[model samples]
Target chain A: MLEYIGKRIWQTLIVLFLVSIIVFVMVNVNGDPVQSLLPPDAEPWAVEELRTSLGLDKPLYVQYFMFVKNALQGDMGISYYQQTPALNLVLDRLPKTVELALAAILISIIIAIPAGAYAAVKPESPFSKFIMFGSLAGISLPTFLSGILLILIFAVTFSWLPSSGRGDAAQFLGMKSSLFTLDGWKHIIMPAATLGLYMVAMLIRLVRAGMMEVLKQDYISFAKAKGMPGRIIYIRHALKNTMIPVITVIGLQLGRLIGFSMITETIFAWPGMGKLILDSINRLDRPVIMSYILVVAVIFAFINLTVDLLYYFFDPRIELN
Target chain B: MQKEKILEVNNLKTYFYTREGVVKSVNGVSFEVNKGEILGIVGESGAGKSVTGFSLLRLIEEPGEIVSGEVKFKGQDLLKMSEKEMNKIRGNKISMIFQDPMTSLNPVLTVGRQITEVLIFHQNYSRKDARRRAVELLEMVGISSPEKRIDHYPSQLSGGMRQRVVIAIALASNPEILIADEPTTALDVTIQAQIIGLMKNLIDKFNTSMIIISHDLALISEIADKIMVMYAGDIIEYGDKGKLISEPAHPYTQGLIDSLPVLERDQKRLNQIKGLMPSPLDLPEGCKFKPRCDYAGDDCPEGTELFEVSKAHFATCRKAQFFSKKLMRGVG
Candidate 1:
């Protein structure tokens, strides 16, 4: 088991290296760092000084090494706009983004797994037909459109909760302070809702297809023949078998959540790295933009690694080696 | 002959409802097995032998229904019971072991959990007790190192070993009647003999009745006290194993017997039965077997009921008297 874990760790590190290089190359494309970093009004000497200071004057390889060195030490240079340490800025907003992303994933899985299993079990039922169409609609619909639809309904119509921001800290973090409890949840509500709707739809469709295929396996028939309870068959036998494929989608979905949260974060005005990246893009803050891209890349790679481990645990046939 | 009959299936009809018109899979099949007797139901592929076993356990659900029948176990009708009540009988009192032992067991669960889980649900045994007894059941099936092997997953085991695990699970609850559906068909001939030997020993030791369902006559001859031959969802011939083999009553049964690739006949070229069993969807107006039977004549009609060909041997063909040695050659 230790050897298997060691192998996976090695593979993950290799993937991280590839991701790091890709992130660096992507951030640097389309413009010279000097153009983005130094304003046009700046003196030629000042441009050269800024280039040398940021290590852009050095060879690309040297700059890359410096970038790697700072990233390892958790010094993500500085934000181009705020001029604050990029790492600190990203991390401060990181939690909000992660929490929302996680909520989206959790909500999606909760909706999808049961819906998928039920759809599989009763293929011809009207509920199944509705769920099938609903899932398709979910998968095909744009995240931005769904976000807009949600904002219009709960925010414009109901007006029960704040339309944006992680509400108040006391509202979210204050359980003992009863008045702050609803406020905390309300603060994060719109962002969570916008992100969760599309994810729920995508996840439901994948889970339903997975559960349907699993239900048809010989082992399922064997389980039923053994006279096991229907629920046991669904949860234990069918669900476990369904997970290998679901995990594949999960890996893809996690990467997607981080990559696509830009729209969701923007629509709800949630203070997250996604919005930070966009803000940095508009201002052309090379350091902040690069750090945001790098951080998201690292997260995607890490999630993939964890997902592989989960697959290894769930599927007995999959040897970590 | 007078032993208490544990199961008696009478005129059972199971049809497969498909997009096209219904396929009459098991059409009006009937048979009985007494307590402690090994009754073998043998037939070629598509002969509805496995369907008979599945139908006995009420395993055939939606898309296929037991259209008409009385499957009585101790005079209690199985078909009439709700799924809840039928489930009680499936793995406890009347357990069934399916064909393809590899696929029969779930891959995800360990052999130990799979075996013991049934005991927990059916007999109300606690987990600890069930686990302890699961070992005993594994040992009973002649699996070596039952304690060590019980924790192993299905994929970890060999084909023969998996089959043994399947037997252990089937016999875990000490079922009154164990149904072995082509249990040996998946293994090599030597392994097949060992499986057959293990089953006979286990059946004798436990004193539990069994219905060994297979198409191989030689296999059925080893354990079956009585043999029933099925053709196109109908029993064309059925009687004592020795009598059926030596002097088959029905023309189809005789054709099957003559085509046997037994040890004594190995010196000569093996004979294969000519033509397939008639389709159940489009059976002959008279006898279903008339189209395939060598001794088929004017009287050999589908409507003819099984008539006594000998003292105990019964056959469905009407022209049994006109059958000759010359007609036997036409089968191969």
Candidate 2:
């Protein structure tokens, strides 16, 4: 198992390296940051001095190597806009994004697994039909629209929740998170729901389809023949099998939730990496954008590795070697 | 001798309500299994042998319903019992093992867990006691080093070993009867013999009545005391194993017996039944096997009901007399 993890970590490093090169090339190939930084009436020599100071005058390959060397030492240059270390800026927003993603995934799992299992077990029931219909609607509805609707319903009309921003956060395990406070939970509910709605919809369908397929296997019939209680048969036998595929989707979706929660973040003005990345992209803050993309790539690799490891746990047939 | 009937069925009809039409899979079949007897239900695919086995345990799922039946176990009407009551009887009083050991046991579960679950559920054995019993059961089923093998998952075991685990699970609660549907069909030829031998020993040791369903007539004849031959959804021939094999009264049975290759005879080619079994959905009018039978005559299209071919032997064939006489002359 240790060897398997070592192999996975090696693969993850290669993937991150490729992602770094791609993000570096794509960011540099776009219009120059120097052109955007200086004012229209600025002297040409002043612009040249600013460019030299920012190290933009160097060749692209040399700049990339310099960036890589600094990145290896936990430095990712300075954000042109923020005038702070790019990695620090990204790391500052990382906690909120991770919290939101984790909460969203927890909500999706708590709702989707039971709902999906029910849909598969009693597929002909009215409640199952309703769940299926709701999931379908959830999948089609855009995050911005859903976020606004939730804000309108809970904040504007019912006045049950705060519509925007992260409320008072308490430090837990060296990370400031809203999850510990009731008021913070009220503030977070809308954005998390908006961010997690599509995942809930997708996971429900995946779990249901997977459960249905597993339920059809001969093992399920044998379990029934063994006279196992319906609860044990469904949860212990069927749901465990269903979780194999569902876990894969959940890992991938969690990575997506953390990285691409831009629209929901924008709607609610939640202080997270999505909003930071969006701002950096518009201002052409090369350092922050590069760090954000690389961070997300690492997250993807990490999650994929975790999912592969989880497969061995869920299915005994899957050998780690 | 008057043997005790452990299970008796009266006109059990399990039908599937498909989109096309109602598939009468097990059409009004009646049979009985005596205590300590091994009854084998033999047929080709789609002949309702497996359905019959499932119907006894009420394991038939959606779309397929046991529309009408009276299943009496130990003089109690099993069909009339509540589902809760049936659950008590299933796996506890009457356990079942399925074909394809590779697929029958839950892959994620350890063999010990699967076996112990039955003991815990039915017998109310404590976790510790169940674990101990599970090892004993595994050892009884011919699995070596039961101590270590108990912790291993189904995938870790060979096919024969997996089937042995399945049998161990079935017999964990010491069920009065076991229903094995095509038990050895998914096994290797050599493994098949070993499994068959293991099952025979286990059944005799426990004195458990069994209904072994399979398509292989030769395999059935080896283990079954009584053999019931099914065609389409009906029992065409049923009798004592010795009588049935020696003097197959029905033409279909005769064809089936003839199809077996004999070691004494160096035949250039093996005998085969001329045609395939008729489709269940669009069966021919009258006899279901009329299209496939060489002895099919003018009167056969009207269909023939099962009649006594000999004492304790029944067959549904118009030319039963002529077929038996031909068989007798051939034997002489």
Leading candidate by lDDT: 2
Which digits, one per residue and each the tens of the lDDT, describe model 1 over residues A1-321?
788778867877888788778877777774775776667798999988887777777787887898899889988787756879988887777777777777677777878778888888888999999998987787777878987777788888998767777755443443222224567677666676567766677667777788887787766766666778788788888888887888888777777777668998998888888998888888777778767776777788778778877876786767655
Model 2 per-residue lDDT tens digits across residues B1-332: 99999999998899999988888899888888999999999888999999999999899998899999799999998888888888888888999989999999999999999998899899999999999999999899999999999999988999999999999999998999999999999999999999999999989998999999998999999999999999889999989999899878888888788778888776678788888877678987778888877777776636546778898788887374577677545543
In candidate 2, stretches whose alpha carbon ends up further than 4 angstroms from where it belongs are: B299-303, B324-332
Candidate 2 has which clashing residue pairs, if any?
Answer: none
- Which of the numbered candidates is closest to the native, going by highest DockQ? 2
The 0-to-1 C-alpha lDDT of every candidate, in the order given, reads: 0.79, 0.90
**DockQ metric for all predictions:** 0.58, 0.83
Global local distance difference test of model 1: 0.79
Candidate 1 — which residues are off by over 4 angstroms?
A32-49, A168-182, B262-268, B301-304, B318-332
Instruction: Determine the TM-score of chain B of model 1.
Output: 0.93
